[model samples]
Target chain A: MTAVESSVATLDPEEARRLRRERLERIGSWVLPLAIMVLAIWLWDRICVWNEIPQYILPRPGVVLQTLYNDAALLFGSLLVTLRITFLGLLLAVVGGVGLAVLFAQSKWVEMSFFPFAIVLQVTPIVAIFPLINIYVDNQTAKLLLCAWIVAFFPILSNTTLGLNSVDRNLRDLFRLNGATRWQELWHLRLPAAMPYFLGGLKIAGGLSLIGAVVAEFVAGASGQSSGLASRIIEAGYRLNAPRLFAALILISLAGIVIFLVLSLVSHLILRRWHESALKQER
Target chain B: MVPSTTVPGMEGSGKPLLSLRAVGKTFSNGVTALSNVDMTIREGDFLSLLGPSGCGKSTALRIIAGLTAPTTGTLDWSRKPGEESSVGFVFQEPTLLPWASVFDNVWLPLRLKGVSRSDAAPAVSQLLERVHLSGFENAVPRELSGGMKMRVSIARALVTKPRVLLMDEPFAALDEITRFKLNNDLLELWQDERFTVVFVTHSVFESVFLSNRIVVMAARPGRVFQEVEVDAPYPRDEAFRTSPAYAALCRQASDVLVSAINSTHGAAA
Candidate 1:
């Protein structure tokens, strides 16, 4: 037999080609929605620019592009500031969320005690709580941290709690019969099994962190001298510099997209090898 | 189980390797899965716990393997005064860890006992060969066929080298051809290993073919209905399966099963 033929003896080329065609078609299906979005954005940008609507009301894509270029240094500095808080808040959320989830999973009393409060936090708007948190913490940075934490904590806590509690009874018994200590069971079985759920929570928390950072920045701008993309947008709007505001908005959108992609990549890389949901193809 | 002829309790004057003293199991949910199940398993004896579903066959096997605590019985095991291991269990489902490769799955019991992978590798590899699964050390459970998965489970059970092997309907889920092949392979493996086997099965023919003795059980507050002794010779083959003696034993076993069914619900047609 030919080398290629022998290598794929169990695999039929015609069938594989058919499957590839189907899979490629499925990937190609994303093209239409992307095209529609691009077309709509471009058309809206053109119409706004043509209408000679006040620049402050709605900046044209070209004007926004110019503003981004002109204010590159200041914009990037603010971008870094926003990213720092977003990432730090995310780190804190994961640590607090997963740690609490482990505790809650281990005890019904802990879950009952804390889960309602977590739900209450989740439901309470971060914007409404920002001023209060600012008062309690007594620092601009601390207030921002508290606000962002409120926004980002719930998803990770809920997802991880579910993950930790949802271990297979058979697997638990297997560990018990094998003479594994409770600590080993948790470190090995509970942790690994909870990973997919934790990653799932992380993906949600990732996006929420960016939103939290932006919102906290907005509230911070409303209160004091600290300024970020939200403040820049507000300042540009007040000054009738629509291009700069558009630039800030564009940056915020980019941040959200970046967080989505980065967390998605992390989740996929960690879980695709074993988990069915993240897996793109069968081995 | 190596060197084949060393019967555990009956071997060379050692105490009985494993014994069940009036074993009974009643679930907290009011299900009496087994009751007053008295059994003495000698070394190298092929004993089948034969019964229908809910007959406590699996329950009995589980109790022997120490996977489940009997509600009203004590297990007597003499581990040669120094042997730490007592019994090994092969579950009905292949129960191979989906994430671990075949070698790793088989190495679990040994690994749990503080044996390094390298130290356990030779023993695990030898076990793979014993189960006719060489060169498949790296294959995962998802990569294996049903029969192959069951073989891996069997291999995992045998890796610890326990005196008694408790198999709970290990081949019940396999296709007829695969089941027959595995049955013969199991007997061959048993011959080589010489561990006392407590095999659970629902098939009359299978029990007749494999076991030195078959304990038939009745369901619903499960209890032993009767015991049948097979006087068949060793090294039984396909010819033996088709033999008049085997058919007669099967018929006798079936009669006992029907009688038990009749005693229970008058459903033994």
Candidate 2:
């Protein structure tokens, strides 16, 4: 083929190097935060008097680690409960969000009619409604769903709406020229093009669902007979068990971080092939 | 005695295949893009629409391709009996789907007709080979160079064996050497495929090198200003581009363009 025919074979090395440099810069910037975290953990252990502070009032990180080791069964059991609630809540949010997005995208009237309510739901604090929901819903899991849906629904709805609407004019025309039916256009073109945006929204919503689960559990004041990490945390705080309280807090943070990282990793894995945004440095 | 079964534009004999009737286009903002344009696009002919920027050359080609309906007038296609497909279009930009493989992009037209990949593989592969992208089937559009992408676009246009191929400045973006080489390959493809080509370009020499007829246009109420016949033989090469006939035609086209520009200036003044 002539050079015109083979034009797509060339790559810009400069652009590739710039992409590499950007990734390295990102890695470089994270080092300071890592260093500070390590230093702070070391100092907290060294300065705090482990024996002087009562066992219930203030346990050292070492002590919390020991407590974590000792109460692995209880901790793991509570963790499973919280995780179930989070997972179910997130799944429900995705279903609700995608359904609403399709409705809104298909018709401007529906988007206008239902959009204000979504905004209102988004703006209204989840913490305030937790008690009301908890009272109405005897099932703790149902209350957890309500809270998580409130937190997670907006991103999915907003992102999907944007994604569906952001189709290229040329691409739309191409579909038209090809005699593609409306359903074909939607399924083949709009959905695939919107995948990156949907994944982004999903990543944000994953963490939000976890937060919702924890907050709902907190307000419910669930008893340890069938309780979660949030109940244990509240119980520890009320009884002045400082190290255990910190230990519970650490568990919650770890859960949030793990959910966040997992979703981010999933988004990258799904989008890294075709999407420019998800592309990483070769190194 | 002739069989009379040969398609008008497909054989080496030159003849008009399509005609435009006082076609005009005006944007909603009241900008008249094309005004009272008249042209006959002949078969086995390389008709170049040559003009400066915003001359409505691209708009005219789009109108013919049925991509956009003209604000006024009708396009008449003198179809042969029982011909199923008629027109193919290549835009100024490559416009290949970045996500699709080279082979898939070329096979898009056939696929749209409900043809299976296996069924259309021979035609797709042959078209690819014609465009000189022999072994690059699995390569994505982004992986290819700019010129290579345009070739894929060309192959995509030709895959269905169109009667009329409309191109809007297909090589205007490339460097001089690349453009020159593409110009040569395009001529060869046209000779082989035997399809009528309406190529839009702004370069005077380019129009002279490639076209059987050059339709010169002027912007600001875009309209046909002049038409020049090249009267050159097929399989035109670099040698043909450097010949006296080519230089003379280029000068004639350039003069017509200059006069068109002067007339517009005079009217504006």
Candidate 3:
């Protein structure tokens, strides 16, 4: 406890307490969520048992999980279909959103003319637009992909535009003084500055893309090899197969979570060295 | 701080690198930032444009750097072909790329001119050493203290070995101790490199300490009010700072600045 002991090798009691508290917090972050999930599942099982609820009305977690294990081939194949749409939608949104945002940054007139159309696409519900998409697109997968892309497109476009436009004024002047071409300025300054915002938009779009795919599948109401989890849920609902419905629902949620975690990891890796948001991690 | 070595001051004997003849700038928003300003910047001269707020001292620096064009009159250049684009600028803030390391920041100008890092390393490192930032090359601007960031900024400016260094209040945001140390270091660098400096600062004492010649400007359609010669020997140090001669020059610049604010003197002076 003496001040003389604070030379280099050891921490004082206060420092030790802080370190212990930090470690506890890190552990609790993951453990608490998992514990709560287990507790919730137990409570759910107990309620079903206590009431003698029929499995058809509200299947127990065990029933749903068992259904998942037994029908792994069907469920996994459907999950891959939904995941394909999510990833492809996300990819198209990134390419189209960033490409348009760059054009917007370059020419104000182009942005002024087209930005309102983008807003229109964002504001209109995908449900309402499906009729038009249904008429125009013959392919079911194309319709689902288009719907997903539309949902995920807005955030990337807006955030990247904001980042590109918000360049430091003095740095812009410095670039001009050096007689930098517009291409060089965009490559060296705007794009790099816009990276954090683009990554932020990417995180939001990742989750949204999955949601869009699920919603599109629900609306399609098609049943087949590539109809995805939502359609499988629909098929289970008409037949009153609650376990299969719950299993499909759980698969969709898991897929969304995995997408979010992967996108967040990418963002962290890209920004950890230089960005203000990432620097706070202190790793 | 380095010891003051004997220096044969340029004493305005160097040829005119560029001249601003009746230059004026009116912003697109209908603000006349500068009016009929005339200046002859000579090679190797330490010149300060001294003024109050809204005096367009910064506009003048921007004009020299060609960041902004003059609305009226001419900026004639006499520099040879290879040196035409050789102007280094430092802003009021460090204005560094937050993502770049100190070394990469210093290598920016050369990079713009198509020099690879391997090609630019010796210049960047030597300048970093001169700025006392050799050990901090890998640190980002956020990791650095204020003075260290400014040192990196200065190193970036000098890395290209510019013929004219245009600094707009580069040390105004810094603390007194850092300012003094930077001032002493800047004097040594100017003496060693002999680059023309058109420094924009409002501080009377700072102007007297660093500049061989000071141009006092008046605001409200900013124009030159008066010019004062420090006429001090080169390699100015802390000893010169405390000397009566330095005090006299400061007092003289302060008087010109006072009249400039009061607008009591005509532009002819």
In order, what DockQ does each candidate have? 0.34, 0.28, 0.67
Candidate 2 vs candidate 3: the TM-score winner is 3
Please report, as a residue range, the 10-residue window in candidate 2 chain B with the lowest summed lDDT.
B1-10
Cα lDDT of model 3 by residue, B1-269, tens digit: 12122235444437778899999999999999999998888877888999999999999998888888899989988867676657899999999999889998898888888899999999999999999988898998999999999888888888878889999999999999999999999888888888889999989999999988888999988888888877788778899989999998888889989989888345443
iRMSD, model 1, in Å: 2.2
Once fitted onto the true fold, the runs of candidate 1 whose alpha carbons sit more than 4 angstroms away are: A1-27, A281-283, B1-15, B266-269
Candidate that beats the other on lDDT, 2 or 3, i.e. the better one? 3
Please write out the lDDT profile of model 2 over residues A38-106, one tens digit for every residue.
898887776667447566765667999987888788877888888888888889888998889888878
| lDDT agreement with native, every candidate | 0.81, 0.82, 0.88
Q: At residue A55, what lDDT does model 2 achieve?
A: 67
With a 3 Å backbone cut-off (N, CA, C), the pairs that clash in candidate 1 are none
Interface RMSD after interface superposition, each candidate: 2.2, 1.9, 1.0
lDDT of 1 at A19: 79
Give candidates' CA RMSD values in order. Answer: 4.9, 7.0, 4.1
The best candidate in terms of DockQ? 3
Which tens-of-lDDT digit does each residue in A63-171 have in candidate 1?
8899899999988888888888888899999999988999998889989998999999999888888878777887776777777788898899999988888887756
